[model samples]
Target: QFVLPDANLGVIAFIRLAGIKADQLLKNCPKEYWVPGLTYMSEWSHQWLDYVTRTSGRLTKSVRFCDLGDFKMSMLEREVTRRDGEAMGVMEDCYPQLLQTVFLCNASSWIQVPWRLLRPIMPKRVTSKFEIISPETNVHERKMLLQYIDEENLPTRFGGKNAVWPVHFPLPEN
Candidate 1:
């Protein structure tokens, strides 16, 4: 995920699905790996909470932008869903409302399948923050994204002017 340069409106963590390799992910990442991962995220979330509280008070929260372009059903493997559910559960238990919104863009109807499965496992507060958008096809969705995120903070590919975090950039080294 790439953090947008503009922080006037809070952090905007961007993620794109096009670069993911389903087979490689499943082969490489085992379910046992996520527990420690969630722990690390919890630590990070606490730091983020402290930072947001110090800067803009407790009400401010970070948002996520998930670009679903080129998303495939193969990416929704059972292991993936299970890990995601665990992660969301951890977030709810520890961070609570740390994430203000999750903008899902360029999504197709196929999203319903995973949403249906995952929604049942997620709490209302967590699920409520999600905003499924189709900026590629629907004008209303695009407007909604722009309403939440300003054009200058968004990448040009996502209808913004930020060239530093382009959609096609090479993945950063971990």
Candidate 2:
């Protein structure tokens, strides 16, 4: 998922799904919920998907194959603690919409597979006009950002050298 703030900067979310397996990707979405498994996407990210899907621009899925065979997906599940009554799980199947949204995103996608993930069964990658390079470390990531992001807007963490830091906010207790 990404955030295109007025198209000047593209914020691509490159989260590491360390111990998660293919089927366990949305393990905490809860089958009983009205939103089905897609709840794991969060309302905010779904809005971003709506925007990017309509525009068909600046989306990438760079995957890496890591050795995580011993990791337990069950261990990652969060316990339910409710302050309000029955607000979380209201069952309805939302898989169709989720599938369609994913398909639309894939239509305008640039997928990158690290060399370790290259397999004979994998599909051939199509060439993209837009350059979507995934740098290994923060140093390399900063260099890649230099091409698309201006020095003023880029974060210091990514080697922007900007003096100011982004505001930190605590997560909502809800």
- Per-model C-alpha lDDT, please? 0.67, 0.34
Check candidate 2 and list the clashing pairs.
34-90
Compared with the true structure, model 1 gives a TM-score of: 0.72
Model 1: per-residue lDDT, tens digit, 28-60?
A: 877787766756755664565456567766465
Summed backbone clashes in each candidate are 0, 1
| Runs off by more than 4 Å, candidate 2 | 1-11, 14-29, 34-43, 49-114, 117-121, 125-142, 145-174
Worst 10 residues of 2 by lDDT: 99-108
- Tens-digit per-residue lDDT, 89-170, candidate 2: 3211322232111110111112334422443444533222123333323355446555544555444434454444331223
Per-residue error (Å), model 2, residue 154:
7.4
